[model samples]
Each structure stands twice: as structure tokens, then as C-alpha cells.
Target: MAFNGKYELESQENFEQLMKALGLSDEVIKKYKDLGNIVEFVQNGNSFQTSYNYGSKVITNEFTIGQESEFVLFTGHRVKAFAKLEGENKLVITMEGMMAAMELSGDKMIETLTNGEITVKKIRKKI
Candidate 1:
């Protein structure tokens, strides 16, 4: 799959606001605000395993397409999310009041997370 790769954060938008909305503390946000995160993905047919490596912390989740599974958010909040494929290289996950879309093109993956009116966009390059 196009999403099966290790990626490093290149840039992000409205990260601080999203962190605050997710109930993260100012100290925690400050600690990660300027740091780049590494994300890795492994896929096999309809099953996927994704790992978000944030320096000292790493959150990993395994789920199948079109199924509800437990997903751990960046804030350490766990929720039941459903994963669906929009196109060949795009995956959309919906949970609670938030939606995350991950689209892969060339060597970059653009991930957008939306909670109500607040949206955070993270662009990562395959490494």
C-alpha cells in the first residue's frame, strides 16, 4: 500500500490549537510543538498497523478497514474509530466528533484531523 512507509514530519498547521482542544497541557504542547514526529505504517491487505513515534513516546494501533477499533489519539485519549477508504491512497477515520483523513501522494502523506471547527494539518515525507 502507498501508506506503508516510515515518514518524518515536514510541517504542520494549527497544532497548538488542536493540542489544546484535545486537553493537552501547555507544558506538554510546548514540549512537542517544535519537535518532529516519526510515523510508521505496515499494511497487509485490509489490515493496517500504524505507529506514531514521538521521541520518548510511541503509540501504535492495529485495525482493519471498515471496522471499529480502539485508537489512541496524540493526547493519549482512546476512542473507538471506524476506518474507511475514500480512494486508492486515501484513508478516512472517524471517531467521536473528530475525523482524520490521510492521503498519500508521491513521497508525501498529508494528514488532516478535524474536531468541530478546529482542523490540524500535518505533512510528512517518506523517509
Candidate 2:
């Protein structure tokens, strides 16, 4: 089961909590809430790229699994993340205090993220 494909955002849950935990301002948060964010992913084997568009702002990253990879945030903050496979199709990603569990099933990809107190869920479909 190769996950080398592209995916589009379908739905999300607890977005506000995650954004708040990320230290986004009320004005920016409201803007994102009003217009919504668009997320796209391109995966090729253990390496993956994700792009998030919030109207005027965009964040993109490319990283590999089980290795320390550097990435830049939309705000220009540089950080590192280590993504590891839990089993056959589950990817566990750790960055700072944040954790994301990504489950792959055929054409569907579901990701659940948490920052200790805040949680967010995103569902996407291959496109």
C-alpha cells in the first residue's frame, strides 16, 4: 500500500482550539474561521510535503519519516519534526509538544493532532 499520491482537504474538527493553542490572534483566527484553511498533501514514500493556505498566508514543508527534518512556519519560525510509522499505515509525528496521528486507508487519510490540551481532526481524500 503505497501512499504516494495527492490529497485534498475534506473536513476538519476542533480547528479553533488548535489555532488558539498555536498563539494565533483573534483577528487572524476570525479571518481563518470565516474563510477556512485549505490543506493539500503530496506524499512519496517516506517523504511528504504539506501545504496550508489561509487566504493570504501559506505554509509549506517537506520532510522524511524517522529523521529530524527542519521546516518553516507561516510566521517564519524554523522548527524540526520527526515523523515515524507506527505500523503499516499509521504515521506518528512529533514536533515540540504537538503530536499527530495519521491513519491511511486506501483513498482516505485521517489525521488527529493534539498539543496536550488542544485537539484537532482533519479528514482528507485522495485527489
Candidate 3:
């Protein structure tokens, strides 16, 4: 699950496709991309850091994910963000519970969702 290499256009497209497949509208896709590059770090004691990039502006924050209540919590300098997946739905839980459905195309879906740099034409699903 480690992200290797630089971000590429193809990788971005893959990520976009993952979002679309996950039932995210064009608006949501735009906003997620606009949210910029997200870097996640896991540390001691169920604590984690998620750094988000907004163009030239970068915001680094910390929080805990998968430690409480099916939510990914992020606390930043000026704002807090959280996300979650419930059933077929994905949500920005902390921000007024904005939700969308999850769509699974393949492992490329995960690469896209994480904004990974690899361009995978097909991904195998494990049953």
C-alpha cells in the first residue's frame, strides 16, 4: 500500500475513474481533486497524519482513522475533515455527513482512490 514514484496524468485519470465508479458525482470528483494531493502517515498509538495540498498551499494535520466509529478523522490547522464508508456509500462524515455510494471497478479503483501513481489497466478482486 506504499505509494511509489511521482504522480502521473494516467494515474490521476485512474483515480478519477475510481471516484466515478464509486458513485461520486462530477462535482464531488472536482472537489476531491481540488483538495489536492493527500499524504497519509501512521504513527504510534493509533495516531496518524494526513497532509492535504491545495495548490501552492499545503496543510498538514493529524488524527486517528479506523480507531473510532467507522470514520477517518483529520484535524488540520484551520479545519477538520473526516470520511467513511458504509455499505455501498462513502461519506465525508465530519463535514455534515455528505455521502455517496461506493463503486468497485477493480484494484485500479484503489490506486485511483488513493491518488497513487501507478497506471493499472486491470486489478484483480479477491473473493
**Which candidate number would show the highest TM-score if scored against the true structure?**
1
What digit string (tens of lDDT, one per residue) describes model 1 on residues 81-106? 99998878999999998899999989
lDDT of 3 by residue, 24-123 (tens): 7788667665354443333344444444455566555554544333333221214334544334312122432233222233322233233233332322
Clashes of 1: 0
Model 3: colliding residue pairs: 15-112, 22-103
Look at candidate 1 and tell me the lDDT of residue 118.
98
* Models, CA RMSD each: 1.4, 2.5, 10.1
Candidate with maximal lDDT: 1
Q: Judge candidate 3 against the unseen true structure and give its global Cα lDDT, from 0 to 1.
A: 0.38
lDDT of 1 at 87: 79
Q: Please say which candidate is ahead in lDDT: 1 or 2.
A: 1
Deviating ranges (above 4 Å) for candidate 1: none
Q: How accurate locally, in lDDT, is each candidate?
A: 0.89, 0.77, 0.38
TM-score of every candidate relative to the true structure = 0.92, 0.79, 0.33
Q: Residue 64: error of model 1 in Å?
A: 0.4
> Which residue runs of candidate 2 sit more than 4 Å off their true CA positions?
34-40, 56-58
Q: Rank the candidates by lDDT, best first.
A: 1, 2, 3
Clashes of each: 0, 0, 2
TM-score-wise, the better of 1 and 2 is: 1
Task: Show pairs that collide, candidate 2.
Answer: none
lDDT of 3 at 112: 23
* Residues 7-119, model 2: lDDT tens digits: 66688889788878899888866776634245666778788887877677778888888789887765567878888887778888788778888788888888898998788
